[model samples]
Target: MVLPPPSHSRPSGALARRAVLLGTAAWCVGATGCSGGAKSPAAGIAPAASAPRTPSAASSSASASPSAPGTPSASGPAASAGPGGALPRARPWQPGPGEIQPEVKVAAVRLVEALGTWSRGQGTDRAAADRAAALGIPEALAAQLAVRAGSLRPHADAAVVRVIDAQYGGILSDTASVLVVCDQPTLAGAAVRPGGTTVDVRLSRTSDGWEVTALHPAAPGPAEALGPMAREVLAQSRIELPPASVADIRSGAVHDSVLRAMLQLAGSHRMSISVVRSGHPLDVFGTDHPSDHPLGRAFDVWRIDGHAVVDPASSRTLISAFMRAAAAAGSYNVGGPIQLTGGATANQFFSDDTHHDHVHVGFTA
Candidate 1:
C-alpha cells in the first residue's frame, strides 16, 4: 500500500526566484524539482463527472482535512491595475515545446489574452472594466489590486485561479460564461480590508470574435487552483515528483526515464518493483511501478529479471555508470543502493540489510 508522506512534511514555502513569474518553467518532470506520483501503483484518481466547485467551500474543505489530499487550488493572478487606477492587462504568451504541463499552458495563455485586452481599453470606456466585473469580478479585490498597482512590493508571491461557469435562465438568452479569478492581497499598511469582490466576465460571440461584455464582482469568489492540478494528474496518471536522493543511484524524473531507456537499450528488459516498508528492502510490493511513481520524487529499482542487484559498495560503481547514461538523457538526483547493515558499506542511510539484495535508485524533483 502507498502510505502518503506526513502532510506536514511538505508545505509551500516562499517560492524560489525562478519559480516566480517564469510561470510553468518549474513544472518539468525531474527529481530535483517538485516531487509527485500516482496514488495507486496502477493508475491515479478517476475523472469526476463535472469539474469541482469554486473556492469559498474549497477553503473549508482543505482546512477540514489537513491530510495531503484533495485537488490543487487553481488560484493565480488575474489582471491588475497600474499606479493610476489602470489594470495591468499584459498580453498572453505561448508555451514552448517539451513543456510537461498542459493545463498551465492553456490557462496562462487565456489569462494573458484576457488581461491584454483589458489594458487596451483604459479610460476610452470602463467598458473593459465593466466587463471585468460582470465576468464574476471581486469587488473588494479592486481596491486591494489598486494598492498592488500603486506601489508593488515584493512580499510572498500569491496565486491566481481560473473559473468557468455556465449561466442559464434569468440572464439574456441563457449562455455559458468563463471568468478568471484573481485574489488581491488582504492587507495594506498593517490594516485589514473587508468584503472583497469576485470578478465575473460575460463573453459574447460577435462578428469580430468573442468579446467581453461586462466585468463585475460576484458575491462568492472564484474557485481555488487545486482542481486543475487534479484534472491534469488524473489525465496523466501521475503526481508531482520532487527531487531528493540517497547514494550514487538516484531516481527522479530524469533517472526513471533513463532506466526505461536503458532497459530499452539493453534489449527489452521487463521490470517489477515492491514498496517494502522500512527494514524490508529485499521485499517487493506491487508488480510494476507506475510511470509516475508517487514514492516521493525518487524510486527504488531492484529485481531485474526476478533477481536481486544487491551489494551497495561494489554495485555502486556499476550503478554510477547507469546514472551517467541516465543523466545524459536528462535525469536528476539519481542515487543508488541503500547502505544497510552487515558490511563496511552497510547501514549508511538504511537501517537493515534487505537492500543488500537490491538497488535503490532515488530520483529528485
Candidate 2:
C-alpha cells in the first residue's frame, strides 16, 4: 500500500522541549549506569558482537554445532592461543530475555548461520544440507534449504555471518516470523569485503520447540525510475541501508513521509537503517493491527552517528536527539529505548524491551 506525501511542517515548541528532556534523561542514565551495560561489537571484524552472557530458555533448546570441519567452539582452546595461533570462535547469536518467544527466534537465527557461514574452500553445493544435518533439521526441510542456498553466489572463499539483531516480524501461538539482520565478512585471497542481508524466517511451533519451516530472503522488487525525493535519499552518503531497503526505495514502495524524515535526520547524523518495508513484520508482533512498516510508513534505525543503538557505550544523548528529531520531522509515532514523558498526544512516544536496540519512526499518512 502506498501513502501520499505528507506536508513539511515544522515541529512545535513543546515537542522541541521534549526532545531536550529525552536527551538529558539519556545522559543521566548513561552516567549513572542505570541502563543495562554491554560493549559494542567492533565493526568489519571477524566474530561480530559477543552474545549475551546469560543464556535464555531458547538457547538451551537450539544448540550450536560446527559450521564446518575444524570449526572451534566458543569455549575451545582458541581462547588461550598464542600470537600465531587460531582465534577464538565467534560466539553463537542468542535472543535477549525481552524478545518475544526467544526460542522461536533462536531456531531461525541458527538456520541462517548454518546456511550463510562456511569454511574456506568448502564446496557451496552441499553445504546447506550438510550444515542443516549438523543442526538436526529434518531431511525434507534440509533439501528445501539446499535449493534455496544453491542460488546464493559465493563471493569469497570463506564467510562468517554476524547477526546485528533479530526481531519479531510477527508471532502467534503456533507460528512466528523472525527478521534476522546480519552482515557477513568474506575472506578472499588476502582481502575481506563486507556483505549481509535481512531474512524473513518462517517457523512453526512443535511439541519440542519452534522449528524453521521456510526462508524468505528480501527481494527489493524491480528497478524503476523513482521520485526525486526517493532518488535523493538513495544517494545520501550519511544514510546507510541494507540492499533490500535500497531496493524498497528504488521500487517506490516506501512513503514520502518516511523518506522526508530520513533526509531531515541525515542532515544532522549518520544513520544505518535495518528495515524499511520489505523485511519487517506486516502486523505488529502478536497483534492483528497492521504495522506502518509493511504499509511503507515506517523505518527502523539500528545505528546513529556510528554508535549502535544496542550498545551500552553509545551516547544516549545522540539516540534521544535522533528520536525526537524523527517526531519533529512529521512522525506521528516514535519509539526507542528511552520512554519520554510528554508527547503531543498519547502513545506518541513509547519504549519496550523489544525496542531497546533500535529506534522506530512511524507515520500516519
Candidate 3:
C-alpha cells in the first residue's frame, strides 16, 4: 500500500483567517457553549466538577467462588439472539437512590458504554477497539482490550451489565470510580471468560460530563473473581473505593484476612454500608501516625445499613455491635464514636473526635 505525499498547501490569507478565528473564540467566551468546552492538557479525560454525596441503593444476585459451580443463565431476553447473531440489548445505567451525584452519573454512563461494547456479542477485535475508542475509553485501558479481544470468538448471545457499586472522593477536587459487574453466560453455565464480571472504572468530571480516565482488570491475565458472599456486600452495600483499592485487589495487595472479615460482617448485618477509605494514601488530617489504609490493611466505614455513623441512639447500637463484630473477625484495631472495653482488650478500641463521623476497622498481617 503506497501513501500519498505530504503536500504543504494553504489557502490565500490563511494567517488573516487565523486572527479571525481567535477573535471569534474571544467573544464566544462571553456567550454560551463555546468557551465551556475548554480542554485540560494534562488530564485530557474530563473536566472538573462537584459530585455531592447521596444515599445508595442497589439489588443484585451473588456471584459464586471459582470452585463453586455456576448457575446456568436461564432463557431470557439476554439469551435471545439479535441480528447477525448479536447479543441482546443490555440495559444502560440509571441513577438509583443514592447515586444522584452529577459527576457519578457521568462516570457510570461512560463505564457502561465502555464495558457494554467491549463485551458485547458478535464483533471482531477491530470492531471492539473501534467501539471502545468511540465510547472514550482511555488508551491506557483500550490498548489492553484490543489485544485480548483479538483472540476471542464473537458471542452467540448478548451480555448483561449490572452496576455493582460506585465511589466518589477527592481532596480539593472531584473524582470518582464506578464498579460494573457483567456476565455473558454460555449454555454450559460458565462465564464468557472466568473473572470477566468485575470492572472498576475511573473518571473525573469535565465541562461536558464525566470522562473515564482508567479501568481495572485493564491488562489481563485473569481478573479476580468475587465469591458469592463478597458479591452480596458489593451489590447491596456502599463500599466506596478508589482505583488504588481496585488495583490492590487485582495485584494481591489486599490480605485475605481483611477481605474475609469484611464479608463476614456484611452477611451478618444484612444492610449496605459505606467504606469511606481503602487501599489509598494515608489521609492524615494533622500529622498523626500514617494510616493503614494505604497498605490495604485497613478500611473505614462511614455509613452502615443506610444509616450515617454519626446518627444517634438507634444508629449507635448498630455501630457498636458492628465494631465488636469487626474485633471478633480478627480486626486488631477499631475506632469510632462509641468506645468499648474488656478482656480480648481495651487498647484495641479508641474514641476520638476525628472518628466521630465513622468507624475505622484495621487489621494486622
Candidate 4:
C-alpha cells in the first residue's frame, strides 16, 4: 500500500514567532472544548523513562559494542561564562508545504516542545502547563501535560529540546498519531547532560486544526534476558533508536528477521531508527493492508551515516546505498527518497514523497 510523500524541510528559528502566536491565539472554547473523539492526555500514560544511553566516546569505536542499555554517558554542553551558560533554545518546528496534514504534525511537535523545555529556575511542576496554555492548548490538556512532565528528572536548572523527526504513526479523517523524536540537552549550574525521549502523541481533528489529546511517553520495559542476537543489536554502537523503539526491542515482540537485518545493515553504516513496532500504524497509512511495522517485520531509518535522509544536502549516494543494502539483507519491500532500478522484483524499490525522509525496510518472514 502506498502512502503520501515525505515533506519535511530543514527547520528555521521560529521560537519568537510561536511565542507571539501563543499569546494571541485560542484553540479551546465553548463547552465542547476541541474535539469529541479526543483521548485524555492522562490516559495510558507510560512511566517516565530515560532513553537508552548514547555510547561513550571510548565505546563508540567502529569495532566496539555500545554501552549497556542504561549505562550513563557523558554530560551535554559545557557551561558558558555567563550565569548558567546560555542553554540551547529550541527553534519552533514548522512543516514544509509538502507535508501531509502539516497542522496535525505541528500540533504534536509543539506540545512535546512545551512539555520537555523550560527556562532557568522554573519549577518543573507548572512550567509545562504554563507553556502549553500559552500555546493555546485547553486548560485541561495543559494540566494533564504538567502531570506527565512531573515524572521527568532533568537534573538541570534549564533544558532545551531539539526534535530530530516527527512522523505520522497513523493519520485518519478524524484522528491521528505522531511519533515525536527529540534530543534534550539540559543545563545545571554549569554542567549539562544530554537526554531525550520519543512520545506517541494522540490528536483529534477540529475545524481550527488538529488538537493534541494525549501523550504517551516511552517506558523501558521490564528486564528479561534476550536472545544473543537481540542483545547484540541493542548493544551495537552503530544502531540508534528512540526510547519507544528501544522498549519494543526489550519487550520481545520484535521478530528475529527484523533484528538480524538491523545487524546486517549496521555492518556498513551508523543508523538512527525512528520507529519499530510499538509506535506505528497497525495498517498502511491509507489502506487496510496490515503494515509490516505492526507485525514486527519492518523498521524505519531516518539517519544513515550521520546524514539525515530528509536533508537535500545529504548525499544521494549514501541513501541509495542504504536502500540497496536493505534489499540485500532480505527486505522484500524497500522504500526510500530515491527510486532505484534493477531490484529483484519490479516493485522491490520505491520512491515516494511520504518516504522522502527515511528508508523503510519490510520483511515477509
Candidate 5:
C-alpha cells in the first residue's frame, strides 16, 4: 500500500490531470515526474468523503470517547474579505525537473495543516480566524473550523498527519498541482485508526510565491503499507533517498512484492537499507548495465543484523545466510560481500568492491 504524499488542490473526483488542466504536462505512474493520478482541479475546495469529519452532536462515536466533541454549536464565526481584496498574483514560480521549489512546499504543508484546524487548538473563534488570515487562508473557512471544535474532540496531536511523500499533480506556466501523502496515525476519532491520506493540492503562481487555490482527494493508487517494523526501520535505519524516492515508497507506487520482500528482511534481521536508486537516472553512477532499483524492483542492504558488510570481523555466516534468505523470498538477483560457491546458479550471486559494504537484492516481476 502506498499513498502519494499529501497536498491540496481544487476538489474534483474520478478525472485525469489532463481532464483537470488542459494543455499541461501529462501525469505518469512514477512520482519522479508525472500527473496521471488524481481528480482534476475544481473552482473550490470540498471535504474528502473518506476523510474524518468533525463529529456532530448526533454522532460522537470513535475508538476513544470524544473529550469534547461537537462544532462550537453556539455561534457562527465572522467572515472576512472576499474576492473584494486582491488575491495573489496570477503568475509566479515555475520549477525545473528535480528542483525543490520552496513555494510549492510551503503551500503543500499549509494545506494539510489547515485541515487540522480546531476551535480547541486556537481556543477561540478569533484565534482560528487570526491564524487562517496569517496563512493566507479564507476567513470563512477558519470560522467554520473554529466553531467545529468540540470539548471532547481530540487535539491536533491526537491525529497528526505527517506528509511523508510528495509529487507533482501537474504543472503549467502559472498554475501547478501537487499530490502529497500523509500518514495519519491518530485521526480525530479513535475508530479512525492509523492510515494514509493523500491530498491533491492545486496552486497558482503568485507574486510572493505559490498559494493554494483548491484541494481534494487523490485518485486510487498504491497506499502507504508500512507495517510496524517497516515504519521503525524507515525511522531508525540508515536509509537515505532523493526527494522523489520517499514519495515513491510512501505513495505505494513502488512494486508491492519487492517492497514486501525488503520489509520482511528488515523485520527479521533489522537490516538497514542503504540504496534504492538503481532504476532512475541517478542509477548510471557506477555501472554501465541497466539497474533494477530505478524500477522499484530492488533495494540494497548496507548492514545486516547489526553487522556491516565491510567489517572484516563481521561473521560470514550472517551475510551468507541473509543472501540465501533474500533468494528464498523470490529475488532473482542477490549481490553482497560474500560469494557462495554452491546451491546457486552461477549468475545468481556476486561479490565485488562496488557492493563490498552492502547487499543488493533485485526482484523481477
Candidate 6:
C-alpha cells in the first residue's frame, strides 16, 4: 500500500501538549469550583493518566479506572486458578510426609537428575527387589530387608558408591580407582542409622536391559569390591578419560582375565569361558545375604565358550590344566571343582542358579 510522506505527518509533541493541558485543567476544577452556575463537560475533562488504559494481552486482561466508593475493579479480586481456568477458592496443596511434591520430579534434583530420570525402573513386581539387587540405597532394601531383618524403622532406599579418585599405578597397565560411598534417599523418612545395614546387589547389563542380579550386605571378599567397581563404572562411563585408560568391563581391576586364566588352566580340553550373566552381588544372593563374597576377588563362571559345564555335564581337559597352573602360580588360593571327576582340581565350592551358568572368581592382594 502507498503511504504518505514523512513531512505530511504531524509531530507527537502536539498530542502530548494537549494531554498535559487537559490534565492541568482537571486539577484546577478540584481547587476551585466554577463561580458560574453549571460546569461545562470540557472544563472537567479527566487527565490522560486518569482515563482507563487498555491492558496488554501479556499483562492482566482487565482494564482499570478510578475506584468508586466501595466497589472492586473490573480485574475482579485477584485469585489463583486451578487445573481449569476456574479459580480455586480454597484447599491449595500442602506437602505431607513421604509426599513427593509435584515440582520435585526427577529433574528437580540437579545433581542426581540423570540417575533418577535415566535409570530404567525395574519391573513393578520386583521394584523393591530390583532396587535392592541393583545396589540402589540401603533404605530401599531396608524397607524390604526390615521385613526380613525384623525391624520397622524407615531406611535408606539406595546406597551410592561414588568415585573418590583415579590414580594410574604407572604404566604396567595398572591404575587405581577410588570411590566415596553415600546413600540415596528413595523412601521418605527412612534412615540407615549408625553402623549401616547391608544388602547384596548385582550389576548386569543385557542386550535388552540392565539387571541387578543380587543384593546383600557388604561381604568379606569380592563383593566388598563391588561398591568400588560400581562407583567407577558409573563415573568413568559418563566422563571423558585418558587414552591409556580402558573402558571395557574386563579391563577394570575387578574383572581382569584372571577368571579366564583360572578356568582355562584347570580344563584339560579346549575350554572357553562365556559369561552367562555378569553383575554385582544381586546376581549372587538376595539383599538379606549374611556375608559378602568376592568384594575384590571373586567371579561366577558360566559356560566354557558356549559349552555348558554344570549339572551332570562335566568339562574334562580344561578344568585339570587350569587348576595346575593356579597351584603353580601360588599367587592366591583357588577352590572349586575343576579337580573332581578325574580332573586335577579341588571341588570344594558353592553352586546355585546364579552361579550355575558360570564360575565366579575374585582377586586378593
Pairwise TM-score winner, candidates 5 and 6: 5
Backbone clashes in model 1? 83
In candidate 3, how many clashes are counted? 5
| Residues 17-124 of candidate 4: C-alpha lDDT, one tens digit per residue | 112122113422100000011232321135443223321111121111112111112233332324746755454554433356566676777777666777776646
Q: lDDT tens digits, residues 1-365, model 1?
A: 22221111222222121111212332121000111111111111111111111112111111111111111223333444333333222222222222222223333224222322322223112332233233333434322222222101112121122221111100111111221222222222333221111232223322332333222222211222333322332123111111111101121112334334434323322222222111011111111222222333334443233222332223455544443443443334332333222322222123112123223333333
The TM-score of candidate 1 is 0.20
Model 3: lDDT of residue 98: 25
Candidate number with greatest lDDT: 4
| Whole-structure CA lDDT of model 6 | 0.22
Root-mean-square deviation of Cα positions for candidate 2 versus the true structure, in angstroms: 14.8
Looking at model 2, the pairs that clash are none
Cα deviation in Å at residue 121, candidate 3? Answer: 6.0
What's the C-alpha lDDT at position 53 in model 5?
A: 28
Instruction: Identify the leading candidate in terms of TM-score.
Output: 4
User: Which parts of model 2 have CA positions greater than 4 angstroms off?
Assistant: 1-107, 118-126, 148-165, 168-177, 183-196, 202-210
What are the runs in model 4 whose C-alpha is more than 4 Å off? 1-104, 118-127, 145-160, 170-176, 184-195, 203-207, 286-290, 340-347
The stretch of ten residues in a row with the least summed lDDT in candidate 4 is 28-37
- Local distance difference test, each candidate: 0.24, 0.56, 0.38, 0.59, 0.42, 0.22
lDDT of 6 by residue, 23-135 (tens): 22221221100000011011111121121111111101011111321111233222222222322111111111221111111111111111211111221324433333233
Model 3 off-target regions past 4 Å?
1-89, 100-102, 117-121, 133-158, 169-174, 181-195, 207-209, 218-256, 259-267, 271-324, 327-361
After superposition on all C-alphas, the RMSD of every candidate to the true structure, in Å, is 21.0, 14.8, 16.0, 9.5, 16.1, 35.9
- Model 5, CA-based lDDT: 0.42
Give per-residue CA lDDT, model 3, range 192-265, as digits (tens). Answer: 32112333344454445444554432211223666554454344444443222333344444566667777778
Model 3 gets an lDDT of: 0.38
Estimate the TM-score of every prediction.
Answer: 0.20, 0.63, 0.45, 0.65, 0.35, 0.26
Q: In terms of TM-score, which candidate is stronger, 4 or 6?
A: 4
